[model samples]
Target: MAFFGIFALIPLVGVVYFSMVKWNGMGTPQWVGFDNWSASLTDKTTLNAIKLSLIVMVVTWGVQTPISLLLGVFMAGRQRYRAVLSVLYFLPLLFSSAAIGIIFKSMVDPNFGLFSHIPVRWLQQSYLSPTLALPTVMFVITWAFVPFHSLLYQAGVRQIPQTMYEAAMIDGASPWKQFWSITIPQLKYTIVTSSTLQLVGALTYFDLFYVMTQGGPGDATRILPLHMYITGFKSFDYGRSAVISVILAVVGLTLSLTLNKLSGTGKMESQQEGI
Candidate 1:
């Protein structure tokens, strides 16, 4: 906690303070009060970035969570196959974002790439087209993060007593019924935790977009993190960048707390104790 306070908390406090002033990094900061906040709130690019970030978050949750839950449920019942497949699924997590971005970039390149021979050139144009860029990045982000969430769900499934399944089986519960009644409810905490992580990640997503699209085909994939980076480094508008940071922190904290409450994660320990 001490280390976290010194590193994370202190920097966040600095960011909040800096958000109220205009600074170009090398020059003296000018007190701008709420001007940066006002400008950022009304800025078209910032609004677009927020919109794209929300789209990515929705797509990620829609695509990644269900798939992870399904895979986790399937793998939980198969010990031998699970051992092999878990490694395969987790291999993506071992690679750095830059490496994965570069490899995928190559795979989608217009010439001498795997997707180059496709009739429609969908892969080549995915990051280059304004209509497709955000969705394409969302898909890539989902692919990268699914395995981690799957592992979480798998761990949750393992914690569930096998005797409950046996009891359900003897009581004539079909596999699908067991899944709906048992699996889904039992994995509630895992779902909440994974969804929170994915939401926060998608909101602040940057590296893949930086490597793959650089927030282009005209700012289609410019998430808040990328927007913050551009505002700070590229444009030298540190105040506005800090404003984006504070917004991200507040948004992330709000969503995490809301999901925790909705899923009853905060009550889990007390419920278990009562039992």
Candidate 2:
């Protein structure tokens, strides 16, 4: 808690303070009150970035979460070659985001790359197309992060007692019914935790976009973090960048709390503590 306060809490307070000022990050900051926040709220580029981030968040939660849950369930079930499959599933998580992005970029390169012979221009032009850019980036993000979420779900699944499954089987419960009634209810806490992590990650995603697309072609994939980076370093508008940071922090916190409440994790934790 002391370390968290010193490192995380202090920096967060600094960010909030800086957001209310006009600073270029070098000289003394000028107090501009709510000007920076007002400007950030109305900025078209920032708004677009927020929209793209939200799209990534929704797509990740919708597509990646279910897939991870299913993979976790499958891996947790009795199966041959489970160890090898687990290693394969976890291999992607070992790679750095930059490395993954660069490898995928090269693989999808239009010419002289792995998919060069494929006649389709999905990578060449369509990846940068307005309609496809966000989805393409979302796919890459999902591919990179799904392994971690799957591991979380796998742990959750392993915690379930095998006797429950045996009883369900004896009670004539089909696999699908058991899954829906038993597996999902038991995994609620894991689902909430995984979704919160993914949501926060998606909102502040930067490295993948930086290495792969650099928020182009024409800002199609410019998430809020990328926008903040550009405003702070490239444009030297630190105050506005700080504003974006504060916004992201608030949004992430609110959504995470809401998810916990809706998933009943908070109540479950309290009940467990009481017991």
Candidate 3:
């Protein structure tokens, strides 16, 4: 507890300290009052970056969760080589973001990549134009994270007592009916947990976008973390970077609390605890 307390406190202290100063990562930080926060709010680039980040989060929620849940359900009942298949699906998540990004970039190459064989000019066609870049990034992230989400839902599905399925079966419940009545309710916690995890990841994602688009095609794919990185490292605007960091932290915390409140897990856990 003591170690965790100290470690957690360090970030809070740094946020407060840097948020009030103008530091160029050199000699010393100079107190700049609330200039950082004020400037960050008004800076067009930062504002645009925040917008892009929100877009990625929304797209991930829409595209990734449903597919993962479906795959989880499909894999849960099958007796065939489930472990091997799960591992194969999860391979993408095991690679470092840099490595994955480089591979994807190469694979999407127009001149000498498999994507070009589609009879369409995918890579050079600006399929990831300003309006499409963030969505494309969201697709890539979904592909990367979906397997882990499937594992999560699979675990939840596996935990539902076989007796429940037997009972459902004896009652003449069809597979779809059993799924809607039993599987979903039992896996509620897993759904909530995985959605929350994806939300947090999308809210702060940087690597895939940074490597693939570099938030390119004109700031279309720029997310908050990447914006903060560019501000501090690329532009030496530490104060503004610190402000963005604080905002990112606040957004993450707020969404986490919101997700927890909606999870229904708290009520269930409390009831179980009371018994």
Provide the clashing-pair count of each candidate structure: 0, 0, 0
* Local accuracy of candidate 3 as per-residue lDDT tens digits, 71-147: 89877866678767876887887787777777867775656666566775444544456776666667778777788
Query: How does candidate 3 fare on TM-score?
Result: 0.83
User: lDDT of model 1 at residue 33?
Assistant: 76
Candidate 2 runs further than 4 Å off: 1-28, 119-126, 267-275
Each prediction's Cα lDDT score?
0.78, 0.79, 0.76
**Candidate 2 weakest ten by summed lDDT:** 266-275
* Clashing residue pairs in candidate 1 (N, C-alpha, C atoms within 3 angstroms): none
Residue 223, model 2: Cα distance from true site in angstroms: 0.9
TM-score of each: 0.84, 0.84, 0.83
Question: All candidates: CA RMSD in angstroms?
Answer: 6.1, 5.8, 6.0
Tell me the spans in candidate 1 whose CA falls farther than 4 Å from its real position. Answer: 1-28, 118-127, 267-275
Top-scoring candidate (TM-score): 1
Pitting candidate 1 against candidate 3, the one with the higher lDDT is 1
11-86: candidate 2 lDDT, tens digit per residue: 7989876754433442227777778888888999999998888888788889999999999987886677886798
Sort by lDDT, top down from the best: 2, 1, 3
- Arranged by TM-score with the best first, the candidates are 1, 2, 3
Which segments of model 3 are wrong by more than 4 Å?
Answer: 1-28, 120-124, 264-275
